[model samples]
Target: MWRDPGAPADSFYEIRPECTDVPKSRFRIKAGKTLSARKWHAAFSPEGYLDIGKTLSRIHRGGIHPSIRGEVWEFLLGCYDPKSTFEERDEIRQRRRTQYAEWKEECRQLFPLVGSGRFITAPVVTEDGQPIQDPLVLLENNPDGGAIVPPQTPQDNNGMGPPSTDAANKLEKMTDKGVIQWMLTLHQIGLDVIRTDRTLVFYEKKENLSKLWDILAVYARIDTDVGYCQGMSDLCSPMIILLNDEADAFWCFERLMRRLRGNFRCTDSSVGVEAQLSNLASITQVIDPKLHQHLEHLGGGDYLFAFRMLMVLFRREFSFCDSLYLWEMMWALEYDPDMFWLYEDAEETSDKSEEAKARLKSIRHYGKYERENMKNASKSSEEPPLPISVFLVASVLKEKSATLLQQARGLDDVVKILNDVNGNLDAKKACVAALKLHKKYLKKAKKP
Candidate 1:
């Protein structure tokens, strides 16, 4: 009734030359160096307080080194507060790992295959807790995780036979909505997992692939509000690879999702990235009216062509390594020091004195570009401004303005032009140009 976790995976990911050729990211390093490990350690007090303000500043100008990216990301993503001491963080880490193990056990109770070091590409059960007997869906363990092929064990007739006594009892016992939703999403997760970053050597190990599936599955179990979406694997994959510890990677992905969940929330009338696209249209109209008018004339005013870039954070447009580099650069530049407390939703800040509280709100933590926006941004707090990512999309648009305006006679041409930048876009220069374009757009937008 279940695939053996120790069974031969029958799947493998081969490294391609394109995957290894990482582009150099020297982010106009005239101001300061990339946040090296030494600087990272020095920022921490002897008692274990982290100087996040200084840390964010250096990271903004220059990105963090890969050796320490996952650890640094925990702070930036608000997994752990910079104010927490070494012992406190250690305790928190242990508690989180314990919590994650409990979650996996809970899921395993319902579906014994969850932590089995293998994932399903097809549904195993229905909403009513009955087994799905569709033999055609019994897919093979394809090397690339591609869709629909011959079964691995054709002699077994591609049938996932009736649930065994233990499995039947487990499914019949769980009648809760959360468990039901979790069961429904498992097959979808399997399908996406196979397609997610299959070209990387990191995914060659079947256990590594199962590790990612486990993280996503557990995440789905906890974050019931936004239970597993298609593009999430792309976001979660980097965390698993970056943070070797599965629990740490899960928490990191959770924290990262806190900032990005809005992009995944969709409604009847609009997709999640709609707000960013609206902002992009406004930005283009203000900063480059000529190009905006041309786009509108071409019926490309909605700016949906750039949706994939904003949706996956340009994971598709840039090389894998460059994508990570670009994420740190963008996150560093857009950092807000008060973000930690805001993200934590902590009430303890009220207990601190004015001086102590002021440190948390320090503008020094903001990047040069972010500091400018904070100074000149509208005072109305009702409507928060668009994220820096929208501005980054605008920057990409402006970079390709000439080609788009001239050659983009139709929407397809625009898509082709942007897609052509795949693996060629410079991560550093993209950050530099985004900040510059953001400043220019703000000035132009303020005009009467």
Candidate 2:
């Protein structure tokens, strides 16, 4: 029932990236010996540089060396151009740090109570320098006493009526209202942060927990439209742990959110998760009609059960390390080779430098399908890149088709089956299956 933008309302199928066997890496980074800082620097030179596409492909082919993850991820997340020299990137890094600090400062000013971890009962001084009692605290302490008394307004030295004007009172009321809303969101963020990655030892420290809270709070302040959402804490926890730098983690998380922000929108007009669920339904119907029919029979044609999976990109469904690996691989596949050329000036090298040349060539050459689509491009250009997560979800459902068709009598049964998969999925196997299914879907989509 869901339609891709610009597609006919009746059409249920759309093309997505095809699945292919990912090549195994020859230069796998190991624990102690990662892609060194020196080697990373050498990748960029004046005449010719390392083929970023090839380098990232190689990283995806094998896992990133543990030691180099922070540096490599900065490149992967678009924090720096792969071709940028060390000096260029260092300048960019400093500027970004300053920007992040400014945003954090704005957040602090907007929500001082939450940022400073002050109790709600803390006295608020008025413009006249008079301390006002917190009404809620007063109520709590004197529940059995007579009616509560409001704080007395400050009088002038003449001991006449309070000097506070109506305008001042109005401004104070507005500030109090804003603080209340901020406190509510801050409370929810704290709750989610505490539960985010408790299984990991890093979150055991209270300071680490506070860091998670700060990033999410500031993000909420920065993007008031999306504001704070529940599952965001889960997405941010791993970044904080992996990057170890608060600003860097925030920027990485921000880059990720650009792709995922739609999922968190709760407005009536927002497509968000509903559109994705529709994509999953359409994929299932085309690839495995029987399984699709079974789900439809169970009153799950909407496929809402997979909501959590899409929301946090399967963070809960896989182990910590596996989730990170899956994310890196997905990013690699999603990498737009054109992005490098758009951001950097290509330099020619001698024929002897075959490797760099090959990478540059690959960047220039579009896939056959992509070229054909571009010739007839329409509103499709406006669509965001198809996230690999949808196909990944489809792969999981296909694997469980038999069980679902035979055992699932209702929606609850379907939820139980998918829930059982948590912590049991093999990251590599899922990626392969997802790619294969994507390939199959694209082939079918291309046919008359």
Best by TM-score: 1
Alpha-carbon TM-score of each model against the true structure: 0.85, 0.72
Candidate 1: C-alpha lDDT: 0.74
How do the residues 1-448 of candidate 1 rate in per-residue lDDT, one tens digit apiece?
3434232211121354565554332233222467877889999998898998889778865677666789998887778767778998898899889989999998887788778776666666677656555533455545443554333344322222223445444545346767777887887887677667766778766788788888999888888778888899999998987798999999899888888888887777877778888888999999888989998998988988988888889888775666777888787777776666676544644664556546666677676666876777664244775677788788888888899888998988988998888877887788888888887877776678
Candidate 2, which ten residues in sequence have the lowest lDDT sum? 154-163
lDDT of candidates 1 onward, in order: 0.74, 0.62
Question: Could you give the C-alpha RMSD of every candidate to the true structure, in order shown?
Answer: 7.0, 14.0
**Local error of candidate 1 at residue 142 (angstroms):** 7.8
Tens digits of per-residue lDDT, candidate 2, 1-448, equal 4323332211211111231221222223343323444555556667434456545545545545444566677666666655446676667667778988898787666545334422222223443433343323432222232232222213201111111333123224334544445544654565466556555556545567667888887888777678888899988886787687788889888877876888998886654888899999989988999999999988999999999999999987876666766777666655654444444334411222446434545542332223333443463466654567898999999999999999999999999999988877876577778877877876675566
